[model samples]
Structures are given as C-alpha cells and as structure tokens.
Target chain A: MLRRVRYELAGRVAFPLLNALSSWQRQLKRRGRKPRANPFGPPLDCVRKLRELMTAHYYVGRYAQGAVPVAWVTSGFPIEPLRALGFHIVYPENHSALCSAQHAAIDLLQAAEQEGFSGDLCSYARIDLGSALTGITPVGRLPRPDLLACCTNICRTVSYWYKNLASHFDVPVVMVDTPFVYGEAEPHHLSYIEEQLGELIEVAERIAGRRIDPERLERTMRAAWEGLVLWGECLQAGKAVPAPWTAIDGFFHMAPIVTLRGSEQCNSYYRMLRDELSDRVTRGIGGIKEERHRLLWDNLPIWHKLRKLSTLFAERGFNFVVATYTNAWAEAADLIDPAKPLESSAKAYTYVILNRDLEHRLASLKQLAQEYRADGAVLHSNRSCKPYSIGQVDLRSRLAQDLELRVLLLEADHSDPRLYTDEQIDNRIQAFLESFS
Target chain B: MSTATAIGVDVGSTTFKAVICDGTGRILDHLIEPTRPQMEQQAREGIALLVERLGCDPALPISATGYGRKRIPSARQLTEITCHALGAFHLTGRPGLLVDMGGQDTKVVRFGSRGEVLDFAMNDKCAAGTGRFLEVILHRLCVPLTSVAELASKAERPVTVSSTCTVFAESEVVSLVAQGEPVEGIVFGLHRALASRVAALVAPLAVKEPLLMSGGVALNQAMVRALEHALGNRIAVLPRPQLVGALGAALAVRNSQ
Candidate 1:
C-alpha cells in the first residue's frame, strides 16, 4: 500500500515537476543559439514535449518496481495485452537504440565483448546485455523485470536475447513465435500465434497478480490501431514532390510509436505530427533546401553517422524522401483490426517485411518506389542485419531491370561505425550522383 | 610545338603520377615517383617539379585525383574512378567497359559513348584483386616486380593459390613454396586468382564490348594474359596506361576552364 502511494507521488508529482524544469532549462539553452534558417522547414515544435514525455516515462520507471508489474519486451512484441494488465513495460531494444544514437553503444559493446559475447552479435542485444551486466544505461535505471516477453516476428535473435535476460533475472519468459510468412500467412500460422498470445496473457496475468480484462484490451487495441493509422498518414506525406520531411526526421519521430503505442499520448502525438506535415506540404515547404534527386533508402540507418551522412546528401541536393525501414512501422497498419485484436496482431506481426520472403520484399520495394516516385535506390548491405540484407543483390538487379532505377549496393553496418569506410562510400555516392548529370 | 598547358597530379597509394597536356588533349610532359608518406609535401613538390621540367606556366588550372586528391591543394578534385573512366573513354574514343586494377582497389566501369560514366562496381575494401596483393606476394617470394611477368610466362603448368585474402594467400603461397612448388608456377597461380576475382565483379554487368584496361597492374603481362583467359575477350591496354588518371584530371581542369 505504501509502495502504491510512493509510485503515485513519483509518477504524478516528482517526475512531472522535474521534467518541466528540465524542459525549461533546455528551452533557455535553445534560445541562445542564432535562429538560422532550416531548409527542412522549421524544426518540429512538439520535439521538446516529446523529450518531456520520454524523460517522464524513464524517470517514473525508477519507482515502478513493487508498485506495478514490470515486463521487458521486444520492440515488435505484442504489448497491448500487457498494457491491459497494468504492467509497466520497458523496451530494451528501444533503450539500446537510444544508446546507439548517443554514441554510447561502443563502450557497452566492448563490455559485452569482454564477457565472451562475440563482436558479430546484434549491437542492440550486446548493448542491452552489457547494460544488464554493468548496471549502466542512459536511462536512470531499468526496473527489474517481473516478466520477459519476446516475439520472433522481428528476428530469431530476440528469442535468445530475451531468454538470456530471463535467465539472468530469474523471471518467466513469454514467447510469441510467429512463423515466417512467404506470400500470405497460412491459417495454421495465425492460429499458432493466436494460441501463443493466449498463453502470453496467462503469463502476464499471473505476473500482475490479477485477472485479464478483455474490454480494457479492446480499448488499448483501438488506440494502438488508431495510432498506427495516423503514423501511416504521416509517412504518406513524403509523397509530396519536395517531401514535407526527410527520412532522418522520420527515424527520430518513430520513437513515440515504438515505445508509447496503445496510449492516448501516442495517438495524439501522431495526429499532431501528421497535421504539421500536411500543412508543410500545402505550403510548398520541403525537407531540404534543394531536392534535385529523390532516392529511396533500403535497410536500417547508420545511427552513428546520421549527421554526416545526412549533410553529405543534403549538400548534394539529394534527399531520401522515404525509407523501407521507417515505412515498416506503417505498412501493416491496415491489417490491424481492433475488433479481433489477437488474430489481427498475429497476422500483422507475421507479415512484417523482415518476416516475409524476398519476393514479397521486392514487391513492396517496387510499390514503395512507384508510390514515392523514387528515381533511384540505395540498398545498404548491412553487416549486422543478415535477415534484412540477404538476397539484396538479386533485388538490386531486379529493381534496376524492372523499374529502370539506378541502384547502389552500399556495404556497411547500421549501428557499428567501425565497419564503415567514409572514403569509399563518398566515392561511390559521388560517382552515383555524377551519373545523373 | 604543343606547349605544356594544363596539369594533373594523381597521388595514388603506391605511386605518384603527373601529366601535362596541351589544349588538344595531347600529352606534352609526364613524371612518376614512388608516393611519399606525407602526401601534401609530395604532391606540392611533385607538381612543382613536373611544371619545371615541362617549362609550363604556374598559372594553369591544376586538377587532382586518387586516394589523396583532397590532400593536394588543386583547383578540382575528382575520384580515381571518374578520372580513370574519363581517360579510358578518351583513349578508346568509344563506349566500352574499363577495368582498372590499382594498388588497393579494382574497378569495373561502364561509360557512355560520350565518356560519361554509366555504371561501375569496385572491389569492397579488399586487396585481393589489386596490385598490392601481387606486390606483397612477389616480394615475399624473392621475385622482383619487373620479373613477375617474365617468370610467370616460363611456367608450363601453373599451381593454384586459391585464397582471396591477401594474408591468407601469402601463407598459402608460403606453404606451396615449402612443398617445393615452382616459383614461376606459384606466381602464375596468384595472377589467375586475381583474374578470377576481377571477373566475378564483371559477371553481373552487361559489359560493353572492346574491354579496356589501365593502371599499374595492367603493366603485368602475365596478369593481363590471365585476365583475357578468364574474361574470354580481347583486352586493349590504354596508351601509357599509368598516366590515364593524371590525363583525365588534366582534361577535367582544362574543360572546366
């Protein structure tokens, strides 16, 4: 009972006050800088609010233990059910991504490597394990998980990554194994995932020490579904000739949907972003000063080099108007039916680009290219993401032949900067752009 | 008489080359030297020496290309890939494929009929299909760079050295040496390995006919023969192939003027 009191105090009073103070201080710092013109239109006004929302979330997490059930889950895991159970969810993958963006991942990666983890392992997994072992994180503190949930819809690595977390924390692990979908998912595959989701609820119910509520889950699913719909609308704004925003902006803006889905704030945030982007489109504003070439990006971003990479292309009047990675978040929104949450989630998660066959991926790439009116494509042959990078050679050739698009296969890792060669990539990009001349 | 009009300097990994070209794209003067560690110093001194030797005006626009193109304070900087394509297109006067195997990189470039680069592929951060691989292996095997082609030609049957990694291939070559394999056969085998690697990069492209070759490695007679055998096509070596990148740079600066 006392723990509940303390939790309310932290969530409602202390964290909100602290977050407000931090936001005010940041605004003061921002005011000192010269108000230079931004080619990508003015910066998003709600960004500081976003920082406040995320900071309060993490800050409140410190007091979540003993007050509510804590479940550490994958980014793609079915989290709506957990929300219905009143669990305080923590996404390690998202946190590791934050670490990667801040360039704090290499030290943590080295820490994991020293403890027998291979350097070739997924960087997110390494950063998380390294944080777990060292009790170090950019987030104030990660509440100890009462449950670990993992879904294989993203990749096979998450299952093992979560299992290790479960073993270390000595907690129960709930696995939602979505079979890889080739074309359309087999009915059996959906049933299998539905059954696993049912088991997941039981596990989450036990952890929460309460009964599962179907009506609450329905409400959560409705919000999640609406949130995704808004996100898809936001991304569709990129079809504007100059594009209302760049893909780098999209990469950062995706945080709310990834971390705060199934919440009112998450839905409202997307609505705001969508409206802003739509207004930009109507005003003839573009993401870059000049948009000479519209290219489509394939695979994950180089988190460590976003600034340098974005500037290089921006200066060349090249802007990546859309990306397959960011679109993955929105492409499956139509498949999510709130009426039958479990069955639809099973289907939607299974059909993600990573889980589908190369043919489906190629078709999706073609559709996106046509829809976005991309003149060329840059396919990153990422070293860390084999699931995403496999069969790209064939895809590159097909895109060129079928779409008559120029394609460049860039070899680099998304998270690890050590794998990138700046000089080589510079030469390749210059040559590619020169071809257009 | 054609006077020294424009200048180009190519600061490559293994060698530095400079060319002085007249307004008509005709070469009037040229210089070559082993590249020094301090690229800025070498590029400055090399450009001065070339201009002095050619009795050229110092006010001419100078363009630079290669790995250290930016190191040289020049009027224009272009990548070796573009420069090589430009030089090859001028040399052949026709649209075709170009294969330039340098010290550290191997490129397969396809240019349009008017000397514009259409498509290209380069070996990824590896020295297997490059001049450095042969240099290291030959130096280890007690064979001089000039003798590699002569000795490799004498071997009736070549031994196979299959590793694509430079370090591993060196070890494999050493193991073959320990087994009493003939040096000439081993050298020829190394050439074949490199040829096959370069061929794979070209296999995926719809290569234009009348394939052209350039760069320092193209001077190797055995490697050229191995490449022709692997490609199953006649290879035309550009005139003074080592000067191609420098010549391209000179042409670019002059055209810009």
Candidate 2:
C-alpha cells in the first residue's frame, strides 16, 4: 500500500509540489530573507559580513595601484605573487562559470562545438571560447585578460588555454613547469620549482619596470599564511556535531581564498567565519535538522545527479557531513606559513589542483572522513574527470579495510547527464542506506 | 529449459541491478537494490540474491554495465550505451533510437539496423533535465514522486522552469508555489522543462524509430509525454524500464560466449 501510494505520489503531487517549492524559495531570496545558516553552526550574517570585508579589502588592494590588470587564474603557479608584482590576473574558469550561470554557456558552448572542439571538452573551455568569440560576459562583469600564464601541473588544458588567450590578447605568455608527482614532491622537484619561481620574479620585474620589494612580498606571503590557517580552522569546525556549513556553502565561500590569497582581508574574513563555525560547534547543531547517518562524499558530484541524490539521502535520513574536495581548499589554506611565506605559498599553491597522486588524495579523504566521523563514503566514479576517476577502486578497498568505514562507488559524471540512470542509482542508494541501518 | 543462461548487472550511481536471461533474451529473474558501501560486494550479493530467487545455478557468467561496471569485479564490463542498445533491440526487436534517463544524467543513442551504437549524445554535468532534478523538485514541493504524472496532466498552461541549475531551479519552483500557481500547471511545466532539455541533447543525434526509452526516468509518465511532444513522435517504453541496461548486458554476455 505504501509502495502504491509512493508510486502515485511520484507522478501527481510530487512534481507540482517541487515546482511550487522552487518558486517560493526564489521569492524568499528576492525578499531579502537570505538562506539561514544551517542551524548546525555559525550565523549566516557573520559569514556574509566577513566575506564582504575580505572581498572589499582584496578589491581595494587590486585597484589601489592604478587598477593592476590582474586575472584570478585558476589552480596553478603562484599568480598572487605576480599580482603583487603589478600584473592583472584573469581566471578563465570564473568567466566560464559566469557564462554558465547566466545561461549564455549553451550558446557559447555550441559556438565552440562548431570549431571542432569535442562536445566532451571541458565545459569551461567551451564557455570560455564562446565568451571570447561573443565578446560579451553574461552580466558585463568579466574583465579582459592582459597576460596569460599557463601552469602545467593541473593538466594540458592550461597550456592550450593560455595559447588561445595569448593569441587573442596578443600578450606575452609564461608557462610554469611542475613535474607530476607520482607520490610525493622530491627535493629536486622543489628546487626546479624554486628556479621557475625566481624566473617568474624576473619576468614580473621586467614587466612592471620596477625592482622587487622583498619586505612587501614577505608581507603578502605572511598574510596568505594567516588566511590559510584561519580557513583550515573554519573547515575543521565542520567536524562539530552539526557541521557549521555544507559543501555547497563552502564552494560559494571559497572565492576569497582563491582570488585574494595574499591579503589581510582574506585572513580577517576567514577569522570571522572560523569564530562563527566555532560558535556553531559549541551549540552542537547539525546541518540537517534531523541527522540520522553521516556520510563522506568523494570526488566531484555528478552535477545532474546532485538533487536526486540529495533528496534520496534526505528521505532516508542520511546527511552528507563532509566531502574531501570541499575540505581540500581548507587544507591548501592551512599549508601557508607566515614565517616562511615564499616556500609555504609555493607549496600551498601547488596543492590546489588534485592531479598529483592517488595516495595524496586518499590521505586527505581519509583524514576528513575520520574527523567528520563519517559512517560511510560515496565515491563518484566520474567519467569525464580522469584525474579524479582513477585509483577509486584501490581507494575504496583501502578505506574499507583500513578504516573499517563503509564505501560505495557511484558511477556518474560531474556535468554529463547521459552517464547515469535514476532507478538504478536510487535503488543502490536505498540499499546502501538500508545496510547502514 | 534454455540451453544457455546469461546474467547482466548494472552498477548505477545509486543502485545495483541484476537480470538473468535465457538464450532468447527472456528474463528469468531480476533484482534491484540500493548500491551498498562496497559496489563489488553489493553487486555480487545482488546477483546471488536474484539467482537464488530464480533457483538458478550460482556459476552463471555475468556481464556488467553502467558507470560502476568496472568496479563490479565481473567477467565483462560493457558501456551503458552498449547495454542500452542491446536492451532496446531485444525489447523492440528493431534498432532505432535509444533514450536512457538515469539519476544524474541522460543519453540519446542512435542504433544501426544491427543494434550497434552508431552515435550517442549525453548530458551528465547538470541535473536540470534528469531524474535527480525531478526528485529534488518533488522533495521541495512536498509531493510524492508517483503523483507527478497525474498532476502534470491537469496542467492547463505550462509554467517555465527558469533555472537550469537544480539548486537554483528549486528556488524557482518555490517562488512559483508562493505566487499561487496551480500545482498541476507547475508540475506539467517542470516535466516540459526537463523534456526540453532532453530534447536539446537528442536533437544532435540522428533520431530513428522505434524510439525506445529506458532507465528509471522512463517510468515518469509526465516526462514520457513531454518527451513525445518534444520529439513530435511516440516512444516505446519497456515493461521493466530499469532492467534494460542489465538485459543488454545479459545479451552481450550470451553473444560473446
């Protein structure tokens, strides 16, 4: 009888109710009743204030010296150092994302599709190409890039992206080489990076037509270190009974850390966020109103699957307490050391992208799960993200045997919808939840 | 009794499925369950349970499909597209177009006369048009999943689903509800929105007939109706929609052996 009701409800009441709820939430946002912080931790207002202060300061710094043409480059070589040396930083990822959010991505993506770029090429790439061709940002927000520095550590796409950007902008391009670390960074690799860093400094000095201010560079590095520590602390606070924030919130709040790493404002903002998270921990509030099972997520979410998966889990009384990728940003922030700013900054920057090694990724995930007291781990075997997809089976086996934690391998993609099936996925999730019981 | 028996398993994002078939593509028994912590273990257990239910021998050779196929420790791991094609061919007895909508993603596969995958288009990144997207919308609406089709049928005018992102889409749905839009119209609109998105993906492929719909989303009548309207043609849905991938895998295993 319950099954019959559920079956009926799926088609009739559920669909309409969902549409109504979605519309209502939008209205609430427009009315200035911002989403409350998950009662698990920290007030939303506090986090917002901190974020505003940090971003404002960072922007002021960027605009302070005649508007340094800085591009907030994605995960790669220490572009912050270059920005400090008086160059504009451009982040293609951010621009591409803006296009996506604005619904301009489809058109732009289709344009790129005509240029022989496979439909499988990173959506970000397609969006970027589209934006470049269209010469129009969704909301007229993205800044034109002046210089392109492609770092090879993340993937080959960075090089290709820079090549295109350099040609389009007719600017000088720099390529930073970091040998892939199979397991751990070696002294030789560190020395190689140091040499590249010195060269980068030389290039910046030439471009700015100014001498390097060692003290100012040191100061920036110090601020970056402080910011990282606070960020790490904020992430750790999620280990509290009700995590202070969700992964989605963390993603939204990561802008400062990524864009303004070497600024005092970033540190202050994180400090405020940390305090609120700490307060939440003290209050013992979980993100979910009623938490039943706490689970850890591995890899990026299958974007198309997130809603269905989130609902299914919620219905079954399962709450995702932590995710390794989300916490990784915090870990990267923690690596900054004010005392040894340059070395720490270099190391911290290197840790941003996750194309390094299986062991490194596994260790980070294991630590997060343990800290969060996760009952189970759901690994999304994403097809498009090869860097993330590899070594999952080994990781799953190890996590289960070593940590005695339950692990489920979910096959899906971060963006592609054709890769997964609903009924099969729900059944697997339901079974996994039942096993937990 | 059939001289040959084969097993097909689909390790989906959220579930593990097994289908045992006779030599002629007749299903003997099938099992579906939420994927457990260990996919390999869950798959093995699921297959065992199904075989036991059907009183079949435990030594049957198994072929796996879906995203988690490689992780199943099965003898053969085939792609979901391959499985969908085979399943469609078996169910419809002809090769045409295959549309499989799963939790997180959707696919439109073009099959040749021989049921080979000629070309396919997939949407996996965003949840906008997939089953997962519907589930989220359903939860926010406090409506049961089963009622979506009926509610949609009552919709006089289609409401627009403004946001493509599931998170934002939910907010959009909520505001619509607040505006006092009829639940039925909104439901119909959501299905239309999803169908439109799916249609965009299917538009690239050379859509042939008989258009066979597989995967979990095929059960959603509203979605099916919307898709049919979008394509301006009728689609054939299998009796057990979710088992298509597993059936495809079973057929592949039998052919290979």
User: Of the candidates shown, which would achieve the greatest lDDT relative to the real structure?
Assistant: 1
Which residue runs of candidate 1 sit more than 4 Å off their true CA positions?
A: A30-32, A35-41, B3-5
Q: Per-residue error at A341 for model 1, in Å? A: 0.6
**In model 2, which regions exceed 4 Å deviation?**
A1-43, A50-66, A97-104, A301-312, A332-341, A351-355, A415-431, B1-257
- Please provide TM-scores, in order, for all candidate models, with all chains considered together: 0.95, 0.56
Which 10 consecutive positions of candidate 2 chain B have the poorest summed lDDT?
Answer: B117-126
lDDT of 2 by residue, B123-169 (tens): 64567768889889889988798888888887899998878899998
Model 2, global lDDT: 0.71
Q: Write the per-residue lDDT of candidate 1 for residues A1-437, one digit (tens) a residue.
A: 78778878987899888877877887799896988654455676667667777777788888888989999999788899999899988999788878887888888888888999888888889889999989899887998999999989888989888898888899999889989987788999899999999999988888899998889998999999898888899999999998988888888888888888899989888888899889989998888879988889999887888878877787778889889998988888899998899999888888889999999999999999999999989999988788999999899989988998888888888777777898888888877876776
Candidate 1 local lDDT, B1-257, one digit each (tens): 78777888888989999888999889888888888889888877877887787777877788899888888865488888778888888888888888888897888888878777877888997788899999999989999988988999999888999898999999999999999999999998899889999999877775656788999999988989999999998899898988999998898787777
Clash pairs, candidate 1, are none
lDDT of 1 at A24: 83
C-alpha RMSD for every candidate = 2.2, 20.1
Give the total clashing residue pairs for model 2. Answer: 80
Predicted candidate 2 versus true structure: per-residue lDDT over A39-83, tens digit per residue? 232336565454344333333332322344444355555765675
